[model samples]
Target: MRRTTTVWMTGGLGLIAAGVLGMLRDNLVGSAGAPVIAAAAEILAAAALLLFAIGTSRESSVVARRPLGVIALVVLALWPFATQFIGRLLSPSEPIGDLAWSVFGVASVLVPAAAGFIAAVQIARADTVPSPWNRAPLWVFGLHVVAWVVPQLLFAAVGADDIQGLAGLFLTLGKLAYLAGTLGLGIVAVLLANRRRTTTVPVFQSASTDRD
Candidate 1:
């Protein structure tokens, strides 16, 4: 394996270990403050590994899907952090009508904007072959969108007094979903990488025999 590939796979392994530990804690009492935090960290780690793996892959010679995916995942992962900044801008007594409008505006705009960013990356690299794991990022993105939506609906249902509260909830869901999807997709990417290698041998062997 190439140096970068080896490094990435190693990173992926580390992330897998972290995720497992997090899961164990999740099952146990006081595993962590919240399941989402652990999950998000794991996803970010996995994404890092996947990015390296892509850098190493021969397929990446033409296109670096892993990098593209990584960027998307990172954006999704940091999504929750944005709430903190947004909250500071709003006054404590902001009207629900204005708050709701603003929240909806950002969501409607940002969600697709993020997705489009990822899609654009993929589209730019359409000429290259994508590893199975490349698709994993998109899955995370999809869930991220749902994550963004659920809290809004919940807030609307409950009639939250503060838009900041609603924003916090949305961020929480989005972060959790982002992490879960990242870990899941990371596993998928590793599996795909291995599977691709496994399958390549037979084709190479057949070609060698034919050449002989």
Candidate 2:
């Protein structure tokens, strides 16, 4: 792979790891853990943005026309906005003791719920490229959305205040799905990077060289 391609690939994987670790920290970490989790998520999201910018830059060697490339760009662009939207949606002025628990409801759960649908549509399109790993991530990530979102929506719609009661559930199951999806995405990123790299390789022999 070209140096640029390697950088993009590495950066993307690192972002994926950061996002996953952030979700864990946000959900599992307590008062002491808050800053660390939030910081990690911020860093990951920032790295994703940086890599996306470089990948989308005119100077980047990777072709933007490819389907996976397009999806990666779109995902990176939307990720931060999704997190911001969730933060706004969940913000409580009074700051209940367990209120910090709701962060997963928006961050881990809702954002993926929306993004998974978007990814599914893109993957299903006729013009989109196909790969076993890419398709798996698309589907699995979409499913992870369900795993994370349903319980939170159920509890929230009922106006349940026992956030502690559900905290463990969301922290365990919700985070598992979120981490899985992020890891899957990282795998897809690597695959896409490899595909992008191989696309540039030239055939060593001409078609006419084959024996009759």
- Using alpha carbons, what is the TM-score of model 2? 0.53
**Segments in model 2 whose C-alpha atoms lie over 4 Å from true places:** 1-4, 23-28, 31-33, 49-54, 57-112, 123-130, 149-169, 191-212
lDDT of each: 0.55, 0.57
Name the regions of candidate 1 deviating beyond 4 angstroms: 1-15, 24-54, 61-133, 161-176, 207-212
lDDT of 1 at 77: 41
lDDT of 1 by residue, 1-212 (tens): 33433444554565566565555545564645556656555555645544543455544422344456545545544454455455666664766757765775678567646744574356245443354444554556567668767776777787757666567667567547645654564465456456556766788899999999
Candidate that scores best on TM-score: 2
| lDDT of residue 209 for candidate 2 | 54
Q: If scored against the real structure, what TM-score would every candidate get? A: 0.51, 0.53
Which candidate number has the best lDDT?
Answer: 2
